[model samples]
Target chain A: MTEQIAWIAVDWGTSNLRAWGIGPAGAVVATAGSDQGMGKLAPQEFPAALMAVANQLALPDEPVDVVICGMAGARQGWLEAPYLEAPTDLIALGQGAVHPNMPDERLRVSILPGVCQREGGENVMRGEETQLLGLAVTAPTYAGLVCMPGTHSKWARLEGTRIAGFSTAMTGELFELLKTHSVLRHSLAGDVNGPERDGGFLAGAQDGLDEPEKLLGQLFEVRASALLSGRTPDWCAGYLSGLLIGTEIAANRNQIGTDPVPLIGSATLCALYARVLAMTGAAGRVVDSTEVVLAGLKAARASIA
Target chain B: MTEQIAWIAVDWGTSNLRAWGIGPAGAVVATAGSDQGMGKLAPQEFPAALMAVANQLALPDEPVDVVICGMAGARQGWLEAPYLEAPTDLIALGQGAVHPNMPDERLRVSILPGVCQREGGENVMRGEETQLLGLAVTAPTYAGLVCMPGTHSKWARLEGTRIAGFSTAMTGELFELLKTHSVLRHSLAGDVNGPERDGGFLAGAQDGLDEPEKLLGQLFEVRASALLSGRTPDWCAGYLSGLLIGTEIAANRNQIGTDPVPLIGSATLCALYARVLAMTGAAGRVVDSTEVVLAGLKAARASIA
Candidate 1:
């Protein structure tokens, strides 16, 4: 038998593009990605990019419904999907128009809308709708604290599939600032323990979890006093690592109310956040975001199917 | 009529060397500076840098007792003066060298000692001993928090001429890292503000101070939400201002512990920090560092005179 038509799922974002080809049974057969992220391209350019990737699987004219999420469906993405302000459903993440430039004979696509949030007066999240969907789909039991950490960290309080409340933390940028430009630079020396996750980083994160409020002033002091008074740079890095993670712990301490915190990210990042939160005497479970992203993509795909 | 010597003072800092010659009553007779900074030259080079400035004054080696301060007295300065651990004194700050190179020559130089500190477990400061002196001399009998804002901000508890305790905050570098490298950068356009103090900077600082504690999380939202929701770059700058100054407010909330907070800096930086703190119903005062540095230099000279 010849290779059959397959389902297409994608998680297009700011700096990256990821797509998957799934069989009728929902198992992924092939996948592709590129540096051509939505943030770099205009909203109209996404169709051509998606089609370029779709052509890779020799997709036949039998209309392949592209169930796209992430930043690809943002206002600046392939289609202008308006934000669905929380209390969402497939109805909330609505379907937008197909590519006006592409021929009807080549493809049929549906871009997913993102979610908006307003809690404690006003707060919002757009592209994270899918990531939240992925988390909710993968572990319906993941009801407490779910955090997706990266350059922009999103912490959500999930009560089942419905998101109760959420917040974002810019821990990644703070880490970069201290290392390169601040007085703390003298203390960092740009080199630290192996893989950045040796016992030192974990131990430091634990330190943050314990005392978040008093750590900001402490963060700069570690690197500063070290360089001035002859302290090691590695300890400085570990100290800074503690400060940023510690600040996040303080910011999220309240939202993580009641249930244990579950961290979702790549193994290394998850361990770093989890281990640090653990140090605060708060138990945490690390989950894989890739799995959640895939599960989220599958959920979006099923909706279109 | 020959130009007569009045007072001799110096801004003998780490990397910038400046000295002034005044009429007998401390009016500028001649001013000089050179690349021959304490940071650039060895202990032996301090004499040459001093001479380079003195030669510019065209003065004979009279009984002019020159007062020097800043990094020139550090372990690596013109004379290796050790830091006086806190609960410091003018004597401690006055323990610098008399220029072993010229004390016997009737030419005099008194190097000032830096202050050391360990508060909230451990954090110390040097060089600020002079700035703290500057603050006290300029705004004597003024009680409340005095913030000397810079790359590393020193928040001091100044009581008359004595520096009781102080804390350092890395607000500047943190601003750079977030604006240039963080996801938040996507939200910030390339302008720090339109120009000088007339621009949107103060507006941004005001918004930041409005929600000081929620700063870290809101930072990520500015970028991530902007990418998905289309928030402007200007707000990103404001968010950055908010994160940094907001952290400062929380870090220095003790400023309003009993009395009003006094801000010490150039008019611009002090105004910004003052406005942010003002939002919390606290009073503020801005004093010029130029005057403080000069007055600090003068006090240092008379103590050895």
Candidate 2:
């Protein structure tokens, strides 16, 4: 039996590609993901990759629209979907979507533009704008702080349906670099993350929040703590994570207003952020990231339609 | 005519081995260096590597006293010279020197133990301890603050001839990691350090000094600023150096005390630091690292004699 498909939603980032097959009522009927992300794909290779996923999930014999977000719209991705200047309404992201020419008659694709900040300090975001759109759709009149934690974590200020300002912290990247490439690697034994309530993690986070400026000095303590006191690798990992996240939250704590900040990311990562937020006397709630992405894509489709 | 090498002072770090042949009066008569750093050598390979350097710089037929510092004394280096816990007397570093076995009768070597802080936040130092010893010898009554900038930058508080407390910052290593491995690499083009008065560098340092916690965010701005404003690679390099050093200084500013902090490093790096210190309302004086190392080794030689 051929399944009826409304459209395809894709989030192509630097290291991974995720595709979702949506039904008529915004239900995800099938999902596919692979390592063939924007970093690995060339402009010409995008269609074949998309086709492979589309063919695997057999659908009705008719033309279907495909809306993509994330790095797929980056300058080096499939095609440049120029960024939509911030202070622009989040729900209206579709207006800035750019359609790329496709050889396949059965596929019609629209790549959504990211958000770019030109003033104050220059900043840019790709797929996160779609997540913001999802938040705007779920709560049309919502306006406050939203934290998206990942490789390049973003803290955004949303006002009603528009994004007022945002800042990106290279927390995840720094962690990876320090763990894999820096001297701190010698001190760590295995996995660095565990439960949110770990004492070491809390202690490290508290220290970071208390003295965010002391980050450079605090990092060396991880190795010393491990060497001098025989600290376990897991504890070291927790401490390092706590320190990074704690510093990030402390740096941006002023942005949190009356509304409880909503965290949009993976469950594990969001839990970490939520815990750190709670420790810092701020309220944070984790929302389902996949659901938000799907909803965001659906909203974008409606605007274009 | 062979030079009269009374002793040898060696600073063997992770990446390079530098050996200075000292005359009777503590002046460097000959110098030799190689890539035989601790990272690349095993215990069995140390003798051959040292012999190669000693043979190149001809001296007396009899064994000469040698004082080794830095990672050469690490557990994984030539042999373990366990850290001397602080508050250790700088003048007594030689008393803790460990002698590694050598088959060659032409060399008598003593490796200096580094300083470590076991409580209140664990910290450790290796080569910098020797430099501190040199500072003690050069300025007997000097007691206040000292900043040694490098891969693992150290900031120490000195009281009389003892090291009261010290902290290490991963400023240099972090800068290298981000510039070579992170996304910011694309924005950078050439060398990382430039002139002192470079406007971009100064501004970045000022920003970092003002808000050290915002480092993670400010790093991203470098990329965005480059893409949006076409910032040159030299400017980016200076800005990055400024940011890291600035953050480090701001974090450790309380340790500066009443006297001008003395910077113990290479001339170029010390100049950069001196500029930053002046910017932060603190005076910094540059001291020759080699001279300090020779002075330190000579002092250690006296104690062991």
Highest-TM-score candidate = 2
Using lDDT as the measure, the top candidate is 2
Candidate 2 at B294: error in angstroms? 0.8
lDDT of 2 by residue, A1-305 (tens): 65578889988888888888888877888888888889999999988888877776665678999999999898889999988888788778888888888898799999999999998678999999998988888887778889999889999988767999899999999988987898888876575554432777888889889988899999999998877787877788778888999999999998787677899988988998988899878888898888888889888877874
What is model 2's DockQ versus the real complex? 0.84
lDDT tens digits by residue: candidate 2, B1-305: 76699888889888998998888766778999999999999999999999888877785887898789999898889999989999878788888898989899889989998999987679999899888888888888889989999888999888766899899999999989988999999878665444532877798899889889899899999888887677777788778889999999998887677678889987888888888899978899898888888788778766763
Chain A TM per candidate, in order of listing? 0.86, 0.95
TM-score, one value per model: 0.85, 0.95
Give lDDT: candidate 2, residue A133. 88
